[model samples]
Target: MSTVAANAPGAAGGGLEDVAASEASLRRFLHGLPGVDAVGLEARAATLGTRSIKTTAKAYAIDLAISMIDLTTLEGADTHGKVRALCTKGRNPDPTDPSAPRVAAICVYPDMVATAKAALAGTDIQVASVATAFPAGRVALPVKLADTADAVAAGADEIDMVIDRGAFLSGRYLDVFNEIVAVKQACRRADGTAAHLKVIFETGELQTYDNVRRASWLGMLAGADFIKTSTGKVAVNATPPVTLLMLEAVRDFRQQTGVQIGVKPAGGIKTTKDAMKYLVMVNETLGDDWLSPHWFRFGASSLLNDLLMQRQKLTTGRYSGPDYVTVD
Candidate 1:
């Protein structure tokens, strides 16, 4: 709902060229390093677990984007049925009938935007669609903008646009920056309300802490309301370390410009414990200001069930069935 003016005052100017050079240098350093192993994952996970897990009235918001309900492996009718079922019942997966936190939005590809719109018609939940050749973002600029426009016109409340990382990594920072601004411009809603734009950095592809920071700043300066990680389409996706860096970027940006931006760490997050770690990071690193669903979201499909299961465990002292907690 925040309007990020294209010509916002603090827009990255001379510093962008310097940042781009730093990003390239950092990328090369990361590329030369060896791949991480299970030990590293365990160490990081353990370190995060040591942090607090108490739920506040202000819990971190989650965006469960049902990217694909088995694309080629499932029938369209079945997929639609499953999505509808999830929206109708999967939101609150409690057998005891206690209320649960509703997901922030339901994200799907543009083709399913209308279906999602229809399914979530009366609920406060929003409908988000991935446009501009999501997961790759290798399309023409005009076509990408048109894709974003069409999705917004089709009742999408949020638009998740992927950055042209290829261009960015190739040293064309301005091109990538302008592309995001253009797509953001095209996402104005029918009643003149504009859809929130979440720029996916695809951090896995970017591959470094410094480059991630630069990309985060670039996306925010180019009018992104939220800076998201990954599309869940690549071999590597959002991880804790990458998210930690991005959160720092958002925090720094807010301090400098007084503009609060949101962060959505998507992909590879599959458990209540994993979700808790992210929440802990947001709390510790970015402070409580970014704890709300508006400032933070988990772009996940299976995370809700895990959170419910854990909450039930905390209350009833036993893990409930998948049916006991709704899944769609």
Candidate 2:
């Protein structure tokens, strides 16, 4: 039972290799995690989605959602121009309204991290990079670890890394676990102040609510500062039900270890209404502490625009269009 909690912010454990002295112990630890009742999970999310918020509450939720966005551009054809523009957008989402809160960070490919960092200078907005071969994670371990180190070197304030779903699906659980540990270590800067890490599970491919739950615990145990739901590359991404389940995981993890890991729901969440539903889930499940940008985030690109528009409507009492908001 002597666990090594590598990457666990303040956890008391030995090291990565000691967490599970044997494969059998790792399996026992993962399997012993509480099971997910898919039906109940989905039903609870639906019920939380039904909670009504009036004008003031809606406006507050809109602003909170804005602050929680990791304004992202992770396309194959992404460029410095795109990353810089996204950084500008993240810093001042609403040009007409300076009252608008800035997003938590600008998310980009590892190569674009410096561009984003330069563009967002003097602002608290962080520059995050997606590494570890990103969306696919089919590359070799050395390649993945180098990918993470390169991002950290480029001044990424945070790293969003994808787990090797291939290994996880193949039942190489320790491979997946050790990979997270290595990537977390890669986040450390020479100053010893490391970039925060968010581990993506690609829940859609995992194919079951139970798998998502297990992945959540696994990431937490591996020392992920945040557990992310998806990469937005997949067809099914960031559903309210899946996100709600993740919120539950963070809440439970905090209760057990006293380490409050963050949660992020990436992809397909496009509207302020959709964002509010997630906020409701957080408020209900994890309470006010996790409601801020520090503890929660929306790994989104388009979600920022929608939130801006809604914030405009709440301010001016009229709906706005694409013309008013900057197109990233």
Candidate 3:
């Protein structure tokens, strides 16, 4: 029984724009939301992590996690050749086995988007670029928008933009909200369609589970297609409890607004077991609806190699090891 305007892209605090009309109103709306129960959230995530999957189920989860990966290469030394190679691995995580699933996208710096887009041609894989002064939102507003516009023009299918932690932490919620809204608009293309907008909160720096909840709501209200956990450049990127809290925010937001938003847990998720724990949480919290790559994504490089190794073990009953997998 929500009254959200169906056509209002910027509506969510009963109406997002109204909430952002003034910094005071935005603070009231965000703070009015119930506080997070940290102990309860952590216990639930821990319990879900221990849920054992049968062999057959683990195999299926492996493939599903593989398909949901945004095989990323965000190092300072990344070059065009490296990006093309990353795209090739994304197209086939297990080159010896065509039956293996391809990754959802090849995530790279904005400058590398066209190379990735060309390398991934003739495939359904998306080209996701990190923009808006990625990993840090310290730049000015126009700089962020121009960064987004360049990526979109270079053929990025998705734009991952980081929020200004300083603004959010200092209670400048409207500034953060407006930035997300503007970035979403900048994702537009010549065909009138827009690239998917994934807002990165860098949960490690947010300092509290409550802020994670608020950021989730704020991003959704600002027209974010997905709420990502991090940029993978921080000391602590994605953690189960933090990601679980984000999932709850999206679930509640969807219930009140009737709009579905995606969740991405980037950084530190470097193993198949870690990925499985997240998939379990998603299923238990949001059901099978959020299980698809269109609704969920893993922003990792090493995680994909581990998934492929585990897949090989399940199929051939032997370890493929790192030597056999891609160097990423």
Clashes of each: 1, 1, 2
> Candidate 3 clashing pairs?
11-16, 12-16
Winner of 1 and 3 under TM-score:
3
- Tens digit of lDDT per residue, candidate 3, span 238-275? 99999999999999988887788889999999999999
Q: TM-score per candidate, in order?
A: 0.80, 0.94, 0.96
Note the residue pairs that clash in candidate 2: 7-223
> Order of candidates by TM-score, top first?
3, 2, 1
Top TM-score prediction, candidate number: 3
Cα error of candidate 2 at position 289, Å? 1.2
TM-score of 1: 0.80
Taken over the whole model, the C-alpha lDDT of each candidate is: 0.68, 0.84, 0.89
Per-residue lDDT over 1-328 for candidate 1, one digit per residue giving the tens place of the 0 to 100 score:
2223223322544333333244454345334333435465446646875775454421322222211111110123447666576566534445474455566777777777787779877666777788997768787998898889888888887888999988878867767777887887788766766888889999989866657877887887777888899888788888888887778778877776667788888888887667767777787788878766667777776676666666666666788765775544
Candidate 2's C-alpha runs over 4 A off are 1-19
Best by lDDT: 3
Q: For residue 207, give model 3's deviation from the true position in Å.
A: 0.8
Q: Which ten residues in a row have the lowest lDDT in candidate 3?
A: 1-10
Better by TM-score, candidate 3 or 2: 3
